[model samples]
Structure formats: C-alpha cells, structure tokens
Target chain A: MKRRTVGRSDGRKVIVAAVLVSLLSFGPTVRRSDGQDTSAIDRGVRIGIIYRPGVRPGLVMLPRTGQGLDSVRVIVARDLDYGDRFEVITLPGGDSIRLASTTGPRRSSAGGSTATKGATAGALNYPLYQALGADFALDITAAGDTTVATLHDIAAASVRRSVRVQLPRSSDPDFRQAVHRLADQALQAAIGTPGIAATRILFVKDGKVYRIDQDGADQKLVSSTDRQAMSPAWGADGRRFAYMEFQAGKGWLYLQEMGSGKRTAVATTGSALDFTPAFSPDGQTMAFSRATEEGTDLYTINIKNNCCLRRLTVGRFSDNLSPTFSPDGQRIAFVSTRPGLPQIYVMAADGTDQQLFAPFDYGVTGASNAPEWSPDGQSVAFHRDVAGTLQVFVLDVRTRTVRQLTSVGRNEDPTWAPDSRHLAFVSDRSGYRQLWIIDLDTGRIRPLLQQSGARLPAWSPRLSEATSSTP
Target chain B: MKSVSLLLALGLGAAVFAAASCGGNPAPQNTTPAVDTAAENQRVRDSIAAAEAERARQAQAEAERIAAQRRADSLAALARAGEEVRSTLAAMIHFDLDKSNIRPEDAATLDQKVAILQANPELRIRIGGHCDERGSDEYNLALGNRRAQSGKQYLVSHGIDASRIETQSWGEEKPLVDGHDESAWSQNRRDEFEIISGGDNIRRP
Candidate 1:
C-alpha cells in the first residue's frame, strides 16, 4: 500500500527538516515547527505528510488482501478529512514509486530466510519511503485469520501507532468499524484531540433494549419487557431516551431518565402498536410509529405534554413503520410498506409532500426496516433481509450509493452514534443475538453486549452544555 | 201384688238419678235423654275440625313468604356473578393486530374462571372475543373466533370441564366505541362473558 502525506511543501522541505531538528532540541515543549505556526499547530495539527511535489498529502488506504474494499473505509477517511486534521489518499496497485525489492516481497522472503531479516528490512526502507516523500505509512493487513493495522511515522522513524483487533475465528464478517476507530485514534494521538472512541451506542435487540460503549464494551440492558420494546432514540442531551413499549396490550411511547430509571409514557393510544421512536434534534418532540386497525401511521408527540400528538402521515394504502427525523428536524425518513413491499420514504414533519426515497424491488425478498439518518444527515443506514440473512447497508442521498456493511449472519437494525463515525447493530453471529458496533473508517467490529441477547441499539446525541453543567 | 211391683221400679229409677246428680249436674233429666247424648258428641267433633282448619291456614302463609325471599336473593346473586364473569373475561383475552390469537400469559385469568365455574355448577357461560376495526368484516370474524377459542381452550386446559363453557365470535361489527386510535381499538378487542343458564341461583353476600 502507498501512504500519502499532509502539509508537504517542496520549497520548504529542507528548511522544515532543519527547523524540526532545532525545535526538537527544545524538547516536547516546543510543541510546533516553523512554516507551520506554533499557535495553529498547538490548536490542531494535520499530521501524515512528507515533502513531495505533485503528490497529495494524506493517508493512503489499501485493501489488505486485494479484495474489494468495504465502503466503511471511505466513510472513515472522509470523516478524518472532515475533522480538518488529515488528508486521505487511495493507493491503487501499481501506482507511485516501486519499493517491492526493499519493503514488499523481499521483506516477506527475507524474514523467512534469515534471523537478521528484521533489522535488514527496517534498514532498507528508510531511504525508500523518504524518496516517496511519505511522512507515514498506514499498513492495513486483513488476512484470513488476523487483521493488523499500524501507522508508521517515517519522519520520526518509529511506530507511532499500532492496533491488532481480531474477530471470532469462526466468522470473518467485515470489520469496517475496527479499522475506522484505529485510523481515527492514530490521527488523534498523532495530533491532540480525542476521537469518538469513548462514546457508546443505544439500540434495541431481540425486542429488548441495550446500550454499549463505542469499543463494544460494558453492554447493559436498558429495557426487557414481555411485549415488544423497540425504536429507542437518544435525547439530544444524551442523558435521557425515548422508546416504544407495548404494555397492558397498548402501544405506548415512553421517555426515560437514564440514570434514575424513571420513565413516563408519552402516548397511550390503546391497542395500537406504537414503534420506531426518534427524538427531534432539539429533544422537545418525538416521531414514532402509531399502528391501529385502520393502518399504521407516523406521529409526533410533544415531550412535556405527552398527551398532545400530531399525526405526520396519512394515506389510504401506505402503512408507515419506522420514522426518523433529519438532523434539522424538518423532515422525517421512514419505511412504508405502501407499495406492497417495504420501501424507504421521506415526508415533511407535518405529513406533507411525501416522496419515495428508495423504490422497492420485488426481486429482493426481504423487507427494509429501521431507517436511521446519519449524524450529518447526508446518508441513511438501514437493514434488508435478503434470503433470510439480514445485512446492514447505507444509502448515500447525494450519490445514491448503496454500500453493504455486513456480510455474514443475520445483522440488522443499524444505528449511528452521535458522531456518525460508527454504526451499532444487532447480530446473531455469536449463536445468540447481541449488539455489535462497526467503525465506519476501518471496518472493525466489536461486540458491545454479549449475554442475555441484546439488540436494537440507538446512539444518543451529544451532551448538552446545560446538562453537562449540572453536578 | 201390682202395688208392690210399681214401688220397686220407682225406687230403682230414683237411685240412678241421685248417682248422676252427685257426679255433675243432673244429665238433662227431663227432656229426651237420647237427644242430649247425640248433641254433646256433635259439639266435640266440630271443635276438633275448627282447630285443624286454623293450623292449615298459618302453614300456607309462612311458606309463601319464604319462597318470595329466595327468588329475590337469587336474582341479585346472578347480577353480581354476571358482573364478575364479565370483568374476568375482559382481563383474559389479548389479541394481536388484525390477528386473534390468545397469548399464553392470558391463562392466569382463565384459571380464575375455573374456580368460578366449579363453585357455581349451575352457571353456564358463553365466551365471546371480538376484534378491533382493522381488517375486513369476515376476516375479523374469523379472528374473533380464534381469540375466543384461545380463551376457551385455556379454561378447558385448566380443568374448567368444557361442557359448562361455550364460545362465540363477534367480529368488528360490535365495537365498544367508534374511533380509529389506540384507545378505541383496545376497547373493541375484548373477550366478553355472558351467563346462559343456572346463574340465577347464585348466592350473594
């Protein structure tokens, strides 16, 4: 794989190198180098660059086994660039300077042939990478048994970052999420700000509800009732949540304070099956599925009043199930089985100007459900059960690109964390249903909650300033 | 000789009259003795007949009052039992959307019904499960049957002894209220209990 560089200037390469050495003389306190203002670098510095004319300065992402790269890498690379700290590069095979004799096939053969192969290989690659003008090499190795990712800083001549994440030996489902997190962390450590690693996901699984950390840790069950409980959405402040629970044979929407375990039902329209609840961006209103004998529809309820509900969709033939409000809260995207099969549809908040976002294809046997908008509102993630196997897929609104996120086992109900850099989903791959988080940048997968079968994860919005101010 | 015979007969008659006068008042001495004996015997017989007629009238009135109280108590008990049966049945059947299938948890409520049936052997009940206003009328009818059957089957399974229970389905046609929202739907989808026979004799507090 070819690695790219950021902030490379051919005219100042020599000057920057001299200045860097002098700056190092002052120790870590120097904090920045010349040509890159210390103030600007102190605030935030874009790493991964080597001085090379006519070459882009970014991290190059290479498919480890030459298989088709998962779209999660694209999302990761795009997110890093969007963070304004790194440039991303795509190094196709046969592009750029050839270093096969020094760092490629030779290194593999020499390691098997000699005891001194390690030192020899490391020695031979210093000048070769310098000639390529790459500040760091992001080596992503995903083979049959293991996936190892490392960020090597050629300028510092040290292993700046390395992470080895492994999936269960039995199933080799895509690990887009792990790779994304690894990349994001590498950038964070290389620069200064913390990435979206410590965040958690809240979603529903097997009709129960769960919340899991970003690294797929500390998965805890939030709700497990006899009747179906689903469509958990986080409040904008991230400390509270809203979901749908069928209690006393009535579909009711509930808002819960996460810490105190106190819950209040927002709507109780008796036998109707209310589901697919999504909180508005302001945390004041909730959009959810309200199904009666007449037909299912989408409705929004005010959080404070709880009793006042406004119907958002009305039609003769269409039955809407999943309702998700956009980041702006002006529009809602949901799944409607109106066209005889489940399809993605979008409508105004007040049930006006309904338009079909994605058409249903009869060829696909499984239905589409759980339409969740990305944090940025640029794309939507959902699950489609194809031939009894549920897989996660994302639909880019602008490009109309459908990217498959998972390949093995039955994986469904994809939800994005507050940062939109990772997706949490439910998978039955572990012999029991569990919650799993996928790093969109690196394709790494981690099980968030394993025991007692967790499912249906929804990510809470970032904490608000007022809430965080409280003790 | 004729004078001696008359004196003896007169002496005997006078002695008999003296004996009767000493025991009580002289038996109606002068007027026809045979007539007096017949009248005394007739008076004793009439007194006995009058006492028997008075006893018969008292017994008939007492029996009539007891019968009236029993009828009123039985009617009130039946009303109370009917109300309990209706409430218990309402709590028993829970139906899905456009689908009438009794869930297993409903069995707890059905178990209560077995005890009621056992205590009131004369009480025969009709179970009816109805659906909400969702699907076609015919479909809801079938769904309602499934719901009622679910409740009936549960009661029989818990040893209610099926013969006392009867099942019926009233589809979306008989909605408790007319509305499309969740509240109305919940009211419409229900299992109702109706007393068919023998409930009138149920005892109440």
Candidate 2:
C-alpha cells in the first residue's frame, strides 16, 4: 500500500498533544531546580593501566592551511569534548612549543590556558604531569595547504610510529566522510576499537523506510507502501524489528525479520491507536504509546506471551507518547505534555517515578518529543521544536547537559546506534524529508538515505551470540 | 382476517353483478321440451368460463405488486450499506504526522466501536494506522504499529476480547490521500477500521 502524508493541522494537534502530555507530568516551574546539579562528572575510561609509566594517549586536531583556523579550533575542541577522551589545552604558536616544559601536569584554566613559548621537544617532567594528573596532550599543525595530526605519547615520550593522514579538502562534497574517517582512525588508535564512522543508519523517509551507510552511501528503501509506517525500533539482536503499519484501513504491528524479509503481525487491536514501539535491552518486551479519546498513555507488552500486557501510565489531563526504554531496561524515556508543553520525561519501566528530563525554557516554548537513549545508557537524543524549527539535541543523563546537533533544516526523530558513537536522524535539508546520520566524534553530517520523505529511525542492537549461532 | 373478509366481499360483489346481468323476466315452469333444457345448460357453462378468466387476471396483478415491493426493499438495503461505510470512515481516528497516537476527542467514536463489537460476537476486525508523507520508511512502519495498537487498546479496555482483533501498520506505504499539503496530510494520518467477519450479511447502515 502507498503511504499518505498527514495534514499539517492534524500534525499540529498531535504535536500539541504530545507536548501537553510531556509537560503535564512535570507540573509548572519546569525549569531546572537549584537542587538539580548539572555537572559533567563521573566520566573516565574503564581500561586498566596497560602502558609503561611514560606512555600516554592523546587526541590531536589538524586543520587545512586554507581553512579558517578559529573555526577549526572551535570544532576540534567541541569534538574532543564530545568524545570524552581528553581535556583540551591551547598552545601559543605553531612551532614555538618545547615538549619538555609541559611534561608534568598543569592546571587547566576555565577557557583554556595558552601554552608558554619554548615548551617543545620536552624531556621527562614526570613530577609536574603527575601533580596535574595529566595523562596526554593533543598537538595540531596546519602546514601549507594541508593538515597533519600527530598523536604524542606523553608518558612514553614517543610519537605514534604511524603517520596521520590529511583529511580530504573542505571544498570536496564528501568532506564529511573524510572527517568521519579521520575521527574514526584517531579513536581506533587511542581505544583499540573500530569507530561508528562506518556504521549505517535506517529510518523512515516520505512514508517509506530506508537504510544508508554511516557515510551516507548505499541508500535503499526497505518497504514501499501507501500506508503510514513510522517509529522503527530495533530489537536487542539487531536482526529483527517491530514497526507499525497501516494497510487497507487497518493498523497493526509487524515483526520484520531482516534476513528472511518476512513479516508477521504481533497483535491487532482494531480500536485504539498504538505506536512508538521500543524494545527492551533483552528484546523480550516492547513498550509503546497507546492513545485514546481520554488521552494518550504508555503501555508494555511481552513478545513471548501475547497475553502479557500492561499499561504503564494512566490519566486524562496529559497525553503521554513516545516511550523509549533505557539501555538497562529499568527506566523509560518519553514525551509528555502534562506540564502544558512538550518536554522529555523519564519513568520506571513499570511506569513509576516519573520526572522531567529537559528544562522548560521560556525562550523555547515549542515541543520536545521523541527521546532515544544512547547505547551506553549515558545520553539521550531527542527532537525539540524551537521557534517552529525542529532540531535534534542530546542530553547527558549524569551531567544533565543538553547539546544541540542540527542547525539547518528541520531535523527530528533521532536514534543512536548500538556503539553510541553516531546518531541517525531525519532531516528535510534536501528540500524533502530524508534520513541522515551524524558522527558524534567528527560532528559531520551525511545523508544516510535518499528517501524523498522519511522520519523515525531505530537502530538495531548488535546480533546476539545465541541468535547468530542458531542461524 | 381482514384481508380474508375483503376477499369475500369482492367475491360477493362479482356474484351480484352476474345475477343482475341475467334477465328479470322468468320462463314458464313446465313449458318447453328437451331442446330448451340443452340451451340452458350451454348458457351456464359460458358464464362459468368468463368468471374463471377474470379471477386469473386479478391474481397476476397481485403477484406483480408483491415482486416490485421486494425489489424496492433490496435497493434500500444496498443504499443503507453504502452510507454505513462512509460514516464509519468519517468517524475513524485521525493520527498525527508520523505518529500513531490517538487523539482524546476520538473517544466517543471508540465507544460506538465498542458497542459495535459487543453486538456482533462473531465479527472480527482489523485496525490499520497510517502516517503522513514525512520521515523514513522504517520509522513510519513503526509509527503505523503505534496507531494500530492505540485502536486495539481501546477495544480491549471496552470489554471486547483481544482475540477478535487484528492489526496491520502500512506506514507511509498506504495513504488515503495523495497531496503534500495539510489537507492531504490530515486525511492521510488516520486509523482505519475494517470488519472482517460475521457481519457481512448485515446492512452497513
């Protein structure tokens, strides 16, 4: 069946309902409370000390000579901070630093302290670094028309033997891909794991579902029909998914088996409206939004036994929608308008302990819905309509810091891949709605799919060992 | 009983008319011979044949009237069924853009739906949720599921058993309207209801 576009007025009503439900539960004074500590702490690597006392890991950013230095610097700092790998420091000149002078730890200033001259070619200042607890330093060089990145092992007092490659020119249309590749390589060198730069994202576009590589290649449509199919949620194993389909004037939930291309309906209640399905970390249960005349609420249903169903929320004053499960499956993130505007909210998996996650600012009175959790359970990605433009944003759960992702066009329905290194979202930058992917480390965006119109993408979890063996 | 009396009255009227047609003058009681008696017998046989032909004509008219009435009833039923389908479509819940959540105002319609399901025990229905022309294909597929689930939940809450309902989300794959504007979008975001069993013979209206 062919899918149809929803009318704007009706869409607005839905937006209003979703926002109202999210705000109602938060109550008035949706602002961040004084007791709320919005701090970015408790962040560190989990690796054991594998390095000799002198060996250290650091991140470097190099800009092409012709590029804007300030822009490059700012972007590099943001990317590094986002990667959560290093604390950034500023150097005075391109060639004046002596490596020896900064061997020891030094206090980092609020805005970033300028490096002193003659700090290059350093000898071991072990006590100084040990005192500052500085593990590594990043050095960036833009020479001639090319940029070169060098990783310096502060502890070992040795540079990485492999020479870093220059990213493709900024003028190149595929510069985004080049940047992503660079970031991926840097991450791999530092962390010993492949980055999300090469992963692909799947999302709905123009009433059709599509998939594209992380670098925005190999776009293809998964389904072509006239009915509205939305909210793609991946199972724990990543091989299968549960999505909604409306065909022949009926609504149903279909379990799509990726490899076999076969779909089966899980349940069909012909009366109420059901959507926004999220799979548990174990893939045994699914949570979704159930809407009726009284108001929209959240519900959970077990996949194994069709009879095991539970309603998570109940009320007439607020309409709750877009229920997303936390990575640990203990909590859920959703959008409610209970407080009179749409804001992100969190609740227990059984629908208790409800609280608002996003601070309601008067400057941005638009709706914030479609909350998706990062694979590591550290952050959540959601879409908020600011001044009538929908933009994607991420919130660090522990830090309570919000970061905006998209600036141009209307972007909404953001989902994270299992690695938590990238995000797949819907954008209308190409004159029509299409699916796009963003590399978290590089902050570069690429079109994931060429769908003329699409929205709502759910990234599947990595395949489980048991499932892979059975297959 | 009234119809039978009316039929009897018509028969008496026909007999009276036949008597009036006979001449008032009476023939001598014993006069005339065997030739006269034979002539009288021929006249009586002719009158009986004419009466039988008149009754056959009346019966044919009555049969035609009854057949016409049956045809009119059938046509009326068909019209009613068509109206029912239109009304049902109008009463269906309209979904949001890429969302399957049912709006609060649609509750009254759902209640009527519960009544429908309760009245038809053997009837089964399929709920279909749809989305507007936005977002990815896969996401819409999921959104469609949400819409269908929303409808199904309402029925279950209203005391209709879940076993009788089936759901399918067509996503953006199926749409009732084709334009890209708000007008088309509103028409596209909707949850459709289909009766799948038992009530096929019932008039739609």
Q: Candidate 1: interface RMSD in Å? A: 10.8
Off by over 4 Å in 1: A1-194, A204-208, A220-228, A267-271, A304-308, A363-365, A462-471, B1-205
Per-residue C-alpha lDDT of model 2 across residues A3-24, encoded as one tens digit per residue: 1112222343344333323422
Q: Which ten residues in a row have the lowest lDDT in candidate 2 chain A?
A: A33-42
Collision count of model 2: 133
lDDT per residue (tens digit) for residues A379-409 in model 1: 8898876765568888887776667778766
Q: Residue B156, candidate 1: how far off, in angstroms?
A: 26
DockQ of all candidate complexes = 0.02, 0.05
CA shift at A256, candidate 1, in angstroms? 1.6
TM for candidate 1 is 0.48
DockQ, structure candidate 2: 0.05
